[model samples]
Target: MQVIDLLHTATRELAEAGVDGGDLDGQLLLGACLNKSRTELFLAADMEVPEEARRVFLRYLERRKRREPIAYILGEREFWSLPFIVNPSVLIPRPETEFLVEQVLAACRPRRGLHDGWILDLCCGSGAIAVVLALELQRDIVAVDISCDALAVAQQNCRRHKVDDRVALVKADLLTAFAAERRFSLLVSNPPYVSRRQLRQGLDPEVAGYEPLLALDGGEDGLDIIARIKEMLPVIMRPGGEVFIEIGAEQGPALLRMFAPSAGAAELVKTVEILKDYAGRDRVLHLLLSGYGR
Candidate 1:
């Protein structure tokens, strides 16, 4: 069949299945099968698709129709302008996480002193944050995730970006694997913050059905992992270190209170500010420890 015909069929099927951006997904899936760019696919609209390629396109279409994310289907997703391998084992890196990376860079780039300390990436998943930071900061990073499968994918991504040597992938439950003496200058995380009620209420099939639950469930209030990280901050963070954590929009107030100085949640925490995403919603919690730059 012609490329255009297959694209139309895929688009219709995906749209009927309630997939958003069906046309774009169709283009991407067909392009992957043909190993062509979307532009090239359009240019070759009249060209005939090979039988094997056509079959693969149909199979990809079937997966999309079932609400599988295009990133998982394509076996890759672009984060911070670099392609990273992804699968059911890891959460697909979202654009909001880029904000987390941005805040981290902004905090550390201007200060040379912050460069000397250790960097930790909690719940590193596909290692997107670690790989990007390794490349951007040219520093060593220890990335931790609980799932070996997720760690394996993170490893592949690290190697793919040629940052494997700098980004150490560790399979551990949060900071449990770290020693008390292991203080870090900068710690960043995109941990599981989805509440149990949110899960029960439901997420898109692409998330609830395909993404790893280990990376999504944040406990009853969705602050379970964040709370744990908060508890460890006073112990693990350097005197002047900074932390950037991606969080739900509604979570800023709770986190503010959790990390507030008066709350004594984490005594050394000097400031707790929530950074907004593109939508101006609370997205990241930026914390500066006491004695910053000292």
Candidate 2:
């Protein structure tokens, strides 16, 4: 059938199946099967697709119809404008997470003697943050995560970005395996902040059914892990060191209260600012420490 006919049919099918971006997904899948860019796909709209190519495109359409994420189908996702391989093993890096990286870079630029020190990326996922930070600053990084599969994907990303030498992967529950004496100049994390209620209430099928729950379920209140990390600040950060943490949009105020002098680690914190994403939602926390860790 003609390329346009095929796209038109698939788009309708996917849309009926309740997939968001169905038409765009159809275009992308059609372009992939035909080995053409979107522009080429449009130009070739009236051309006939070979039989075998159409079959492959049909399979991709079926996957999307089932709500499989496009990133997993494409086997990669772009973050910080660098492509990183992805799978069911890790959370697909989202645009909002980039705010965390930006804040880190912003905080790093003004701080003297910030270069060359070790950095930490907790709950590292696809190592998106770790890879970008290492490449952006040339600092050695120690990235920790609990899943072996996630670590494998992260390793591929580190190599893909040629930051493997500067990035170290560790299997750990938070910073549990880390030596108590080791301290870092910077720490960053995009931990699982989705409460069980949020998941039970419902999520996009692409996320609810396909994405790793280990990376999404943040506990009953979603603050379990975030709070644990807060208490451990003194163990990992050096005096004047900073941290960038990505949180659920509504969790920022509670996080600020948690880190305030009356309730949390006020003695160690020098400043705390919750930065907003493009949507104006609280997305990242930029915090600096006032003293060296034990």
Candidate 3:
């Protein structure tokens, strides 16, 4: 059959299976099977697809119909204008996390006396945010993760971005690796913030079943990891250092109250601020250390 006809059939099959981006997925698979770009497929719509290519295309379509994410199939995803290798070992980098990176970039930009600054990306899956910092600022990065396998993927990605030299991958349980003498100019993370109850209810099959559970489950209230990081804030961040974290939509006010203590505790102020995505949901938190006096 002509490639165009096959593409149409695949799209219909995918749509029937309830895939949200069925047509686009079908076209991408078709392009992959032919070892051609998606744009190339559009230009060659009328060309006859070889028999082998057609069979492979059908196989990929079958996998998609089962609801496997396209990123897993492709084994790579684009983030921060760069390509990153992704697998079941790591959580897929989402668009929402870009805002966290933006906040960190703003915080880490060069100042007159600040040189050789440091940034810590806690739970640095695939090293996306940390690597970006290294590439942009030419600064040192300590990318930490609990899972060695996930760190391996991050190592590969760091090498691919050519910023591996600037990053130090450490295996530790949240701020444990940092000595009292060490401190970061900026700390960023997109830690596992999904509650255990959410997982019990089932997440996307690709996420709940395939993605690392250690990277997703946030215990009872989804604040397990966040709380640990918060406790470490006073020790790890230098004066005037900041943290940018990605949180679930519903946890905004709770984060604010947690960070900003009053009366018995030091009065927390706007320095621990929240930012919303275009969806108007609180997705990123930018916590400044300026207001806290030593």
TM-score of each: 0.97, 0.96, 0.92
Which predicted model would earn the best lDDT? 1
lDDT-based ranking, best first? 1, 2, 3
Better candidate by TM-score, 1 or 3: 1
Residue 90, candidate 3: C-alpha displacement in angstroms: 0.2
lDDT of all predictions: 0.90, 0.88, 0.82
- As a whole number from 0 to 100, the lDDT of residue 247 in candidate 1 is 97
Candidate 2 displacement at residue 246 in angstroms: 0.3
Q: What is the lDDT of residue 135 in candidate 1?
A: 96
Off by over 4 Å in 2: 292-294
C-alpha root-mean-square deviation, candidate 1: 1.6
Q: Candidate 1, which ten residues in sequence have the lowest lDDT sum?
A: 261-270
lDDT of 2 by residue, 53-151 (tens): 999988998999999998999888889999999999999999888888988888788777566457899999999999998998878999999999999
lDDT of 1 by residue, 1-294 (tens): 999999899878887888889999999999999989999999999999999999999999998898889999899999999999999999999999998999898888789878778999999999999999999989999999999999999999999999999998888878888787737988999999999999999998889889999899999999999999987876778887888999998999999888876777454777779999989899999888887335
**Could you tell which candidate, 1 or 2, scores higher by lDDT?**
1
Using TM-score, give the best candidate's number.
Answer: 1
Question: For residues 145-238, could you state the per-residue lDDT of candidate 3 as single tens digits?
Answer: 9989999999999999898888999999999988865367677899999987888888987676678888888888898898888777767667
